[model samples]
Target: MIEVHQFACLSDNYGYLVHDRASGETVCIDTPDAEACLAAARARGWTITQVWNTHWHPDHAGGNLAVKAATGCTITAPAGDSARIEGIDRTVDGGDTVTIGALTAEVIAVGGHTLGHVAYHLPEAGIAFVGDALFALGCGRMFEGTPEQFWASLARLKALPPETRIHCAHEYTQSNARFAVHADPDNAALAAYAAEVTERRSIGLPTVPMPLDRELACNPFLRADDPALQARWGCGDAVATFAALRAAKDGFR
Candidate 1:
């Protein structure tokens, strides 16, 4: 079993500590703050062995050097962006598999927010560490890729098992829900999820590790193929629905 610990850092960014219970080896996904990750690992009596980066963003990969120096851990990053990411020892692409004790994680290339974005899926543990790709109720902003690429990336994630737990690297569910409601007003699932997310935030709880199927029902971006979204956006196509939803989200605030 892999134990996941969420580290709140750099305002709302999340750094996940994945520990293999059998081996007592810990691997951090997107280390936004190295000190916080170091403290978390030490407190749990787990030896840090690897640092996995989803993208080359400063907020996600900034602490790679610091953590490597402290733990002498190997840094694994996307092959496409290895040149940009510092201290990357092994660069993995889609179809690559990473192992931790008895668990194996598969690599997925889901570039949209960045040119080299990736996600790690641990089938044995039924968890996916998607950096800024698929969020609870929102998708990442298309910074370096086109809408077509972004939609394609999201489709890849949608193909995962419904029971797969999503672990995104941010606490944006509340805001995402609000925007989702605006984009898809008639969606009862969206409205219901928004209310639940509001309560969860009010209680200072992390709204993550959400089931993929639940997000598929409530998240407008994830439900681009739904009839409600298609009708509201005036299109039955996934790409058009995705564009309309993204535009709505951008102007939500």
Candidate 2:
């Protein structure tokens, strides 16, 4: 069995340690800080054998060398931006697969926040490691790719099974839900989810790994094309609705 351990770092960034109990081997995903990753591995007595990066962002890939130096792990990243990413031993694109003991994760290109961002989907395990592509109740800001690209990427994620556990790279659910409320005040599901997230934050608990189906129902970004959301944003056009949702999220807090 594979168990996921989340390590909070760099304010809101998250690093994950996926462990395969059968082999006592672990894979660290998006090491925001190498020290934390090392400590977590040592604490669990699991050998870190691989490092998987979702993109070339410093916060995500900054600690690659340190982790590899400490653990002698192989580093893997998307091939599209390998030139920008330092210390990558293996470069893979969409449709490539990475193995962890008995399990395998398929690479899915879901760029939007960055030009070459990607996600790892393990269908048998019902889990997805999406860096900055899909968040709990929001999507990544459009830094390089266009709205069309973001839309296409999200649609690809939406095609996954409803029960897939979405592992995002940040803890932005509460803030995202605040914008969701502003985008659609009449949405009972959004209101209830926001309240729940607020409680979780108050207690220092994580509000992530949300089901994809729940995001489809409550995330304003995913509902950009919905008729009700378009009407609430004071526009019937699809692009206008998406813009309004992003604007609302930008000014939510």
Candidate 3:
């Protein structure tokens, strides 16, 4: 079994520790806060041996050096943006496979949030750790990439099996849910999910890891191809539809 331990770090950011029982190895995905990540691993009695980063964002990779120094962990990060991330010992891109113990995780290049953003997917484990690439009802803001690049990145994720669990980096689901309902008011699934999110947050719950299938049905960013949304935006091309949705979401509050 792959044991996943999630904890809050640096405001809305989340840190995850994936422990492979078979190999007695542990991998920490992203270092939002070094102390928090190290503490979580200590609490589990697991010594982190590897640190994998999704992008070069400070919030994501800021603690890389600190964590690696503390645990002697090897740091693996995106090759495309390796220069920006501190202390990256191994650089990987899409199509590369990383391992922790007996488990294998495929690295997928998912630019847009950052031109070199990546996601790590363990197909057998049915999990993907996506840092700021895809979020629960929304996608990351276009920072260094264009809408076309981001649209393509999203397609890479959409092609994954619907049952895959998406472990996003931040807790933006509640606000994203509000925008999702606003973008596609007729979506019953989104309305229902919004209600559920409201309840979850009301009791201080986290909604980071959500099923891909649920996002496919209700997330407006993923539903850009829907005829209804296409009609609303008066666009037929998927990229255009996505751009329109992004613009609407940018101004949605």
Clashes of each: 0, 0, 0
Q: Identify the runs in model 1 with alpha carbons over 4 angstroms from their true place.
A: none
TM-score of 2: 0.95
CA lDDT of each prediction against the hidden true structure: 0.89, 0.87, 0.92
Ranked by TM-score from best down, the candidates are 3, 1, 2
Report the Cα lDDT for residue 165, model 2: 95
lDDT of 1 by residue, 95-171 (tens): 99888878999999998898889999998899999999889999999888888888988998999999999999999
Each model's TM-score?
0.97, 0.95, 0.98
Name model 3 segments beyond 4 Å from true: none
Clashing pairs in 2: none
The predictions' CA RMSDs to the true structure, in order, are 1.1, 1.4, 0.8
- Specify the highest-lDDT model's number: 3
Give a tens-digit lDDT track for model 2, residues 113-167. 8888889998989999999999999988877877777777887888899989999
> Residue 143: error of model 1 in Å?
0.2
Backbone clashes counted, model 3: 0
Error (Å) of candidate 1 at residue 31 is 1.2
Cα distance off (Å), candidate 2, residue 150: 0.7
lDDT of 2 at 104: 90
